[model samples]
Target: MKWTRAVHHLTDLVEKVSEMPGTHFRFEVVELWVFGDLLGAPRDLEHIDVALVVDLPVDEVPWLTEPLGAEHWANASRVSRNPVMPFWRSAQAPVWNHRIERPALAWSKADGIAEETLVAVGDGTGELVRLPAPEPDELRKRLDDELALSLAALRHDNQVYTDRRWSPGKLTPYADALWRTTTGYLDLLDALAR
Candidate 1:
């Protein structure tokens, strides 16, 4: 599935959650990514992993870490209770602070609210670690650095995939996806620079 579809799914979930009576959860999407759920099955990858920041009353915070995994649905692998977290606990990344305009996704009941996503990865780290958000100038520098790294990795992967020396077989699609992600980051950098 295209990443857009996954994003739509997230939007729907957010809308639904927001409407539940007495639920004071506020959600902000922070990141979108695609990868094999397991390292051994790269070719069987499906669905986009979304990172979000949710704000709720402190008394209701205990339910956040419940062992409820994800609920498998038609196109989505699992749709678990969206993680409940503090605003600062959202994915830490160098995001360009521009408002996103998705009318359908943005809640209309409230005024002056724009939906956004935070990006993060869970790389086998058993515990959650907090990474503080950097200053605006520092954030720009970090974003620039990350953009350069992504571009360099993309170039190296492109060369490897086309070298004709190594046969990647099924992994070709994976490399293609990586290239797309790299280009996406470049696009983001361009937008931020403007």
Candidate 2:
């Protein structure tokens, strides 16, 4: 399963969640990233990162988390990629960002999102520690940079309009098959202010 299919999977969940009891707001997929951390070279062996935003009640946050976690873990080993973080949460407004990306995973891994599977065997950074909050704009910028290069290369080679960020250009080839095999991941963030 490629990123697109994974996205559809996410949307399926979202639709289900929205129909539940009370206060269900609109949501959007804001980010999608893939990278290979365990792989020494930036060639292969990576993870998929996904993020979505919705305006949901804070009290119900855990409702989404628990179910999503169950689904993610059930499919993690299949992802084959790194720590696939298919995140989704409530936000105030839309995040006008890049469509999809292959390199965003690089930044996400560096930021310690997928360190568990990102590193090679016996490389898990077990135990958690306190850290500063994240800066979405910066990560988004990095994604934009890689996305630009990936798009250019794709257009140059395919000589056609891809329209689909993940598909058009093979920006990240591994993305071509994520739903087939994976572990776990949550790249989504909620911007309450936005």
Candidate 3:
């Protein structure tokens, strides 16, 4: 689907999930990517995925998917360790592997709400209404703190996995990617500050 429609669809879906009876889940759109068309991505890639950072038990996450009424895929929550190969990060990764990285579409949180911008234009005029994006310094400090926590978690996981002679698990790569992205964001913020 087109990017704008995808945003609307995802927003609607998330809202529905939140409003479910007896549901006490809090989620934020940490990342989103709307590709192709007027967007910069190649035309062949036409889809959107919103990465939500949610506070809920992993077992309960499927409840969020059931409302979608589709056979969606999900990975078991664990510390999974795999090869840090660039091949896992390409356009074809989703075909060969299980995951591919993409940019975020909506990323704003205020008063504990996931805020997104919806644009509607048919005539000669348009309107833009969105929660103000977080300030760079705030983002930088947040990322910095997150990176430190991730590193600590990685250290603990490494020790436990080593004791059992077990291979790295999901948390391994999760922490690694967290470190990498957090650093990248910090660098970008630094550049922007200058």
Candidate 4:
């Protein structure tokens, strides 16, 4: 449920991908975070996500533009962040609403990974081990344990959040989304590795 285990798992994912052949370059487990509400998630997802970047030959950037998701990478060209909103950033910040803000968890051009140090870790081992999928019941228990921390955040302003904010039914969509992506992604990565 802690960030460390999620980070370790990400490192494992990166290592697994790197072990595969024909990577444009390499995969880095560069960042992880749990966003929105993770109270009692099926997994202690740091809302966990990772970046896969290749050390494209400086000359080969052209080849990658179409293949490696150039649209998201375009955010890097402006490289800016705003302070008033720690979570909000933009090329020309300190301005208005609907600023074409960059995502807080986006990949950097240099690191090609998320830059949060909250849970970043790696080891220089020669080989890595595969981790079993996390136990869902156990993960939800941990998340439920952590929910006490969010009460303060939700109590601000005239509006107050309560237990009803999270019905078990509300989680089905999130779980389905996670399942669709993680399983599909793992399948794609496995095929690519093969």
TM-score of each: 0.33, 0.23, 0.38, 0.22
Off by over 4 Å in 2: 1-41, 63-83, 92-194
Q: For each candidate, C-alpha RMSD in Å?
A: 16.4, 19.5, 11.7, 19.6
Candidate 2 lDDT by residue in tens digits, 126-168: 1121122236876566344434433443333343223445464
Model 3: per-residue lDDT, tens digit, 16-102? 434343232223222222221212322222333333433333221221121111112111111011111111111111111012222
- Candidate 4 regions with alpha-carbon error over 4 angstroms: 23-46, 54-194
Which candidate number maximizes TM-score? 3
The whole-model lDDT of each prediction reads 0.35, 0.31, 0.32, 0.29
Poorest lDDT segment (10 consecutive residues) of candidate 2: 179-188
Sort the candidates on TM-score, descending order. 3, 1, 2, 4
Candidate 1 lDDT = 0.35
Angstrom error at residue 158, model 2: 53
Query: Which candidate would rank higher by TM-score, 2 or 3?
Result: 3
Better candidate by lDDT, 1 or 4: 1
Model 3 weakest lDDT span, ten residues long: 78-87
Model 3 segments more than 4 A misplaced: 19-45, 49-53, 56-127, 166-194
Query: Could you give me the TM-score of model 2 versus the true structure?
Result: 0.23
